[model samples]
Target: MSEPTSPESNPHLTLVDHPLVQHKLTLMRAKATSTATFRQLLREISLLLGYEALRTLPLTDTVIETPMQEMKAPVLAGKKLAVVSILRAGNGLLDGILELAPSARVGFVGLYRDEETLKPVQYYCKVPSDLADRPVLALDPMLATGNSSVAAVDLLKEKGAQDIRFLCLLAAPEGVARMKEAHPDVKIVTASLDEKLNEKGYIVPGLGDAGDRMFGTK
Candidate 1:
C-alpha cells in the first residue's frame, strides 16, 4: 500500500491507504471485474474505509463483565451517529458502513446531475428530525465534480448537522478541492485518489459510473 495524500495545510481530506483497502480498490478499478465482484469488493472496501473514518470516534468507559468480575470497558460516547446517504450510488457505501454501525440512525438525500449544466438537482430528501445533535457520516461512492456532494452537505448543514464527515470510495482532485473550498468544515475520507475527470465530467481511470458498475447498468 502507498501513503495517503492530503492537501497542503488541509486536514479535512483523508486518503485511506490501508493495504486491504488498496487491494480491494485495485480489484474494483479493473474494467474486467464483474458486477457481482465489484459490488462485493465495494462492500469489503467500504468496511475498511469506514474503519478509518470512524477511528476518532469519542469513547467512554462502561462497566462490563468477563464471566468472572466486573470491569470498565470503552464504549461509544454521545448519541448514535446519523449516517446519511446521498442516494443511488451512495447506497453501495452505505450498506457496508451500516454493517459496522448497526445502531446508527439512517437518512437519505436524493440528487441527480444535469448532463448539460453539470449541476445537481435534488429530487428527494428525508433525515432525522433531531439531526442537529448527532454526528453525521455522509456516504457517497464517487466524488466526481463535487457539485452534488457539496449540495448534499449544504442540505445536511441546513438540517443542523454540525459535525459532519463525508465518506466515499473514490475521489478526483477536482472534487476534493471543490468540497474543501465549499465545505471546509466537513472532513472527507476515501479509499483512492484518482486522476482528473474527463471532458464529460467522469473521473478518468475511475471504475466507470459507480452506480452503473455496481448495478450492471449500461
Candidate 2:
C-alpha cells in the first residue's frame, strides 16, 4: 500500500467511516463529552473498528449438517485469535473487540515513554505462548511518536508473533512512518489521522490521553 500523505493527513489511513464509528468519534471529540460518555464511545467505536479489522481473517470451508442436509460452512481457520493490548489505553479497545471475539486469547504489554529521553521502557509485558501460531491483533489508542508502539511490536516479535496487525483510534504521520520503517509487515487500522505530533509528543487535534479518558483518571 502507498504511504499516507502526511501525519496530519487522514486520506491514507484505513478508517472505518461507518455511521456508528463516526457518531461515537464525534462524541469522543467534543470537549463537553463526559468521562462516562468518552468511555462508552471508545467501546462502541472499538467494536465497529474491530469488525473492519477482522474482515480478512483466514477462513476454511467445512462440511456441516444443517437441519435438512449437509452444507459447506466457513469457519475461522487454524489457531484461535489473539488480542494483545498495549496496556491501559489499549485495554479500552481490547474490551470491545473481546466482546465481539470472546474466544480470542488476551495479552497485555505495558510500556511508557520517557519524555526527556523519547524512549520506551517496559513496566509490564505478558503475552500468550505460541503467538507465532496465531493471528495476533495488537491495539493502542494513539500512534503518535511511535516509540512506545515500536517497542511494543518488537517485544511481540521476540515472542514469535509473525502474523501481527496494529490497531489504533488515531495516528500521526510521524508515528506511521516510524512503524512502517521498523515493522513494514504489520498492517495498521485507524479511525483518523491527525496532524503532526506536538512538541510534547502528543498527536495534534487528536483525542487526549486515552488511558485518562477511559479510566477517569488524570
Candidate 3:
C-alpha cells in the first residue's frame, strides 16, 4: 500500500446515513444502551452498512440454460471477497457482515498498541492466500489514532492485497487524516465522523470502548 502524502486529499472516505443505519447507530451511542442491546445493534448496523458498501461491486452476465430457455444471469466478477476483522472490536461488525455475506472468506488480525512505543504490534494474523486476487474489507469499531488501522493495512498490502476497504462504526478526524496519509488507496466506510481524540486517545464524544461495551466486560 502506498502512503498518502496528504490524507485530506483522499476522495473515497464516506459516511453512510440510511434511516435504519442512522437509527440503530443512535441507539448504540446512547449511554443507557445495555451491553446486550449494543451487541444486537452493532450486528444489525453491520448488515445494513454492508449492503451499502457492496452496492458498487462489479457483476458480469453469464449465459445459463434454464429449463424453458437460455437466459443470462448476473454473477459477481473476480475473486471471492475477504472480510478481515481487526479483532475484538471488529468482531462485532464481522458478525453482521458474515450473516449478510456468508460465502465471503474470513480472516483476522490482532494488534495492540505498545504503551511505551505507542506503536502497533501484531499478536495474530491469518489472511487468505491470493489476497491480491480478492477484494478485502477490514472492519473495526473505532478509529481513534488510526495507528493500528494503518499498520494493519500496511501488512495486508505487504501480503499482496491490492483492493482493500476499511469499515468502522465511528471515526475521529485525526484518525481519518492519519489513515488517509498512511493508506490513501483504502476506502473508509463509517457511520459517524466525530471530533478530535482526547488526551487519552479516545474519540471525543464517541461511544466508549466498543469491545467493553459490546461484551459487558466492565
Question: Which regions of candidate 2 deviate over 4 angstroms?
Answer: 1-13
Q: Model 1: runs farther than 4 Å from truth?
A: 1-5
Question: What TM-score, computed on C-alpha atoms, does each candidate reach?
Answer: 0.94, 0.93, 0.92
- Please, what are the lDDT tens digits per residue for candidate 2 over residues 107-211? 999998898988999999989989999999999999988889999999999999999888999888888888877887887888887878888998889878888
CA lDDT of each candidate?
Answer: 0.89, 0.86, 0.86
Candidate 1: deviation at residue 196, Å? 0.7
In lDDT terms, how accurate is model 2? 0.86
**Model 2 lDDT-worst window of ten:** 4-13
lDDT of 1 by residue, 114-166 (tens): 99989999999999878778889999999999999999999999998898999
Residue pairs with backbone atoms closer than 3 Å in model 1 (clashes)? none
Regarding lDDT, does 1 or 3 come out ahead?
A: 1
Mind giving the per-residue lDDT tens digits that candidate 3 earns over 127-193?
Answer: 8989999889999989888999998998899889999989999888888888887887888888888
lDDT of 3 at 197: 80
**Residue pairs in candidate 2 whose N, alpha carbon or C atoms collide under 3 angstroms:** 7-173
* TM-score, candidate number 2: 0.93
Model 3 lDDT on a 0 to 1 scale = 0.86
Candidate 2, residue 78: Cα displacement in angstroms equals 0.7
